[model samples]
Target: MSAPLIVGSVAYTPNVVTIWEGIRDYFAGSPAEMDFVLFSNYGRQVDALLQGTIDLAWNTNLAWVRTVAQTKGACRALAMRDTDTVFRTMFVARAGSGLGGLEDLTGRRLALGSRDSAQAAILPVHFLTRAGLTPGEVDFLRIDSDVGKHGDTGRSELDALRAVLDDRADAAAIGINTWEAIGRDELMPGALELFWESPVYSHCNFTALPALSEERATPWVEHLLGMDWDNPAHRPILEMEGLRRWVVPRLEGYASLFEAVREQQIGSRW
Candidate 1:
């Protein structure tokens, strides 16, 4: 029997262990069985994937961009969550700021998350620049509370919001997931209001180097895509992982991030 393929993922949350364990069990007795190893951060996970210690990596979009930069187009994305395809950045302000759009952000203090956060940091700047807002017009408050995880912890985004709430900033940029997680609009009522949001972009994916053969990779991806949302056994894991289904990687969704990373000159390591 072939040795089980090893997958790498960052332990961003406590429930990550449960999610991967359930996935491994689902692949049991399959044509391409698998296992996983958790890392302290995405940098370590990406290193494992590059060093041939892991056949696949569950990578954040920032990690994916770095991998492509490091590998020079030698790597390929196998699959991504359905939610990832439509991921977006949210710009919010305390209620009654009268900030309706990016154009209103000029001369305002804007809080951003970790420097490495594509959703909360990099992409927000890109969107602003595209809107013709220059750095001189905006006062930026950067919160690098969770730097190494690339804002996977969501702590940074939360901190950015805190800056806005505490009157340290007039506005904040955060990921849609963080916005939903906080339930700010409903729970906080008039505490905060979203004024601007970026176009949909990709968030995370299963990345693999060319060293992993298609014969081995294909079956694993097929089995992964087989996970049904309606299945009783798969539903909990799906819910915990925040996805309704796995789909082929939407390479187009990553285009904006790639451009942002390039324009920002974000490097692979923190």
Candidate 2:
């Protein structure tokens, strides 16, 4: 018998335990048995991955970029959720704020989430700059809540939205996930509208080091890709993890983020 594959993930929410436990149970009968450990933040998880403390890490876009940089492009992205692709940043404002687009944000107060959040902070700045509104031109009210979680908790995004509602900011940058969640939950019903949305980018993935050989990596990935979205046993985990299917890692969708991180000069260590 071989040792179980150890995977690392951030404890972004309480449900993380349940989610991973379900995944471990699903793999118990498979040739590739698996186990997981949770970290407080992505930084620690990324560090663990790079140090070979774990076989794999569930990484956000920012973490993935940092891992690639730290490894000199030696790391591999194994798989990602279907929802991880086509991620966008939304510029939101109170209805009738007269904010039509990014151009309208010039000289206005803009709220941003955590400094490390790719969609809410980094990419928003990149898009704004491309839109001809430099950071110096806008009054930024940044909320750093859950900075290391990489906006997985959505706490900072909610704060950014609150800033808009309270008139503390004329606009806010948030992830598409938070935007759709607000609609689904009827949060502040009809009080806000999208002013603009950014181009699509990648979000999260299962990243692994090159040292994790195909003998183990191959079976692990095969079992992960084999998860049936239609299976009753797998549906609960899929729903909780916010994906209908696990798809092959889409590396191209991360180009924008890779460029954004470089343009922003976000630290590669963290």
Question: Number of the top candidate by lDDT?
Answer: 1
Which stretches in model 1 have alpha-carbon errors above 4 Å?
none
The 0-to-1 C-alpha lDDT of every candidate, in the order given, reads 0.93, 0.91
For candidate 2, list the clashing residue pairs, or say none: none
Cα-based RMSD of the predictions, in order? 0.9, 1.3
Model 2 agreement with the true structure over 198-235: per-residue lDDT tens digits: 88888999999999998998888899988898899999
lDDT of 1 by residue, 24-113 (tens): 999999999999999998898998899999999999999999999999989999999999999999999999999999999989999999
Q: What is the lDDT of candidate 2?
A: 0.91
Best by TM-score: 1
**In angstroms, how far off is 49's CA in candidate 2?**
0.8
| C-alpha lDDT (0 to 100) for residue 65 of candidate 1 | 93
